[model samples]
Target: MSDLTDLLTVPVLDRSLQGALKAALNGKAKPPGALGRVEELALRLGLIQGRLIPSAARPVLLVFAGDHGLTRSGVAAFPSGVTVAMVDTLLAGRASANAFARVVGAEVRVIDAGVAADLSGRTGLVQAKVAPGTEDASVEPAMTLAQAEIALLAGARVADEAIADGANLIALGEMGIGNSASAALLMHRLAPAPLGDCVGEGAGHSPEGMARKRAVLAQAAARSVATAPLEVLTQFGGYEIAMMAGALLAAARAGVPVLVDGFIGTAAALLAVRLAPNARDYCLFAHASAEAGHRLMLEVLEARPLLQLDMRLGEGTGALLAVPLVQVACALLSEVAELADVLEAAG
Candidate 1:
């Protein structure tokens, strides 16, 4: 990787269309501001596309899967093998995300960011593993700087390819059994919050399991005082989380709207924003996660999510649920008649 830091560049969204887009939205054949956040989303899409008419017709969900060695420390209710299994389920189009994507008319692609198992023979899986899996962060750094760079660059490349293939809307989600623990650690250090606040009951962990997860995360936090974005990611993030951050940056660079999923995804967004503040401009938070510390994460990013279904599933399911809403927001902005036009037609 030749100075992969340059790949993190994300140009701020162009604001030239903001005024006209707002006017057009206000002029739509409805009560002014009647659509609530839908209208706001329309304006955001217009500004992102730099046009009065934005498009969400080609939405693609990139689900990155990885494994974390921290599972060995009893941080999750499920085994790390679940990550590989879920990757297979996603590729087979049997996951909840796939079902939701089918209903919303979006494409799904599964990327093997760093699953511990060999997924070589899996059909329709994007092969971008930087390592089998990350090392246990509660003991040592999750991954070396080079591996983190590779994972981030791989994510960017995957996102760039999706955009090149005409993905107007990019939705990001991740699969890793121990990843919520990893996310909590990332948020604990990067958001500079109390570790207890960041830790949550991932996958319905028992009380004992939750306590163990918290203890392991506390250990990880005590081991690292690194607050820099990349350093924190290198210290505690999973491969899929880094890839999601990479993809977020890539979407911002391409000026595409990004629907960030739940807590894990938000943690990645936080990391991405820390890397490039302007990247936050292109992000549309899909939903507020029910997971612990998610609200704090959103607050730190100053983000208002599009939905609040009390959801904690992390496979881009929440994002897929918000896809049709984005489409409708774009459609209303582009296809709705102006109030003046409607009045003149009546005459």
Candidate 2:
């Protein structure tokens, strides 16, 4: 896999960008700006882009789909086939992510990163297959180092193409069965917390299923720690997780704003941050997910998400929901008239 450090470089928000936004906001007809968080988001975005004017034109939603090896252990409530089914749903524009992206007017692209099943002749899909499936992490490493690298590169390439397509802002989402287990494993590796704390009831898992998921994650983590290095993400991480890391890194290097989704996406963000410390500057945590580990991951990154709707859906729904808020911020900063522009009444 490409060294995340080599693949991504973080962009710092320029002080001048903030100054421009503050000036724009203060100049608005309203008293020193009462636009609230919208104004704040715009200013932050301006700073993120180092421009007094930030454009969110051609926003692209990249939805990466894959299957996790741990699914074979029956750790999730949904069957492993759900991974392929959901990917097909996404490609058919019938999934939640698809609907959300459509509502937000963002173009959506689905990437089949490493689904275990064959999806031949799928229309409107980006065929970036890395492997047939990951190894069963409970028994051994989920994937080889080479497979992990391919997944990352696939994500990076998608981001590059999106940028070329004129997308200045990017949002990430994913579809994968048993991905929660992979996410939990990555969280444990990155944060070194208790397995139970890292685990969550994914895809409507029952309490019993949740327990089994946690046990599987614990076992996978133990095996990975004993045999794999920190870079060996394939041991316990999902292909989607690795690809999301790659896309984030690619976005960082391209100097574009990246809005991250929930727990699985957060795990990928954590990996990206670990590989490239500077990447954090370009990233915006879209929301605080309901997943227990998401908060810990956000805390580790010292990130402040824009929303906290108890959202647990993994289809970038949270990020898409935050889009209007960002747009409003820009509008207020750029369109609102300043107090100075107002005329005093003639006595």
Best model per lDDT: 1
lDDT string for model 2 (181-218, tens) is: 88888888776567778888877787788778878777
Kindly list the per-residue Cα lDDT of model 1 for residues 250-334, writing each as its tens digit.
8888889999999999999999999999999999999999999999999999999999999999899999999989999999987
Off by over 4 Å in 2: 1-5, 11-13, 226-232, 343-347
Each model's lDDT comes to 0.92, 0.81
Pairs in clash, predicted candidate 2: 1-149, 27-338, 28-337, 28-338, 29-337
Model 1 regions lying over 4 Å from their true place: 1-3
Ten-residue region with minimum lDDT total, candidate 2? 223-232
Q: Which ten residues in a row have the lowest lDDT in candidate 1?
A: 1-10
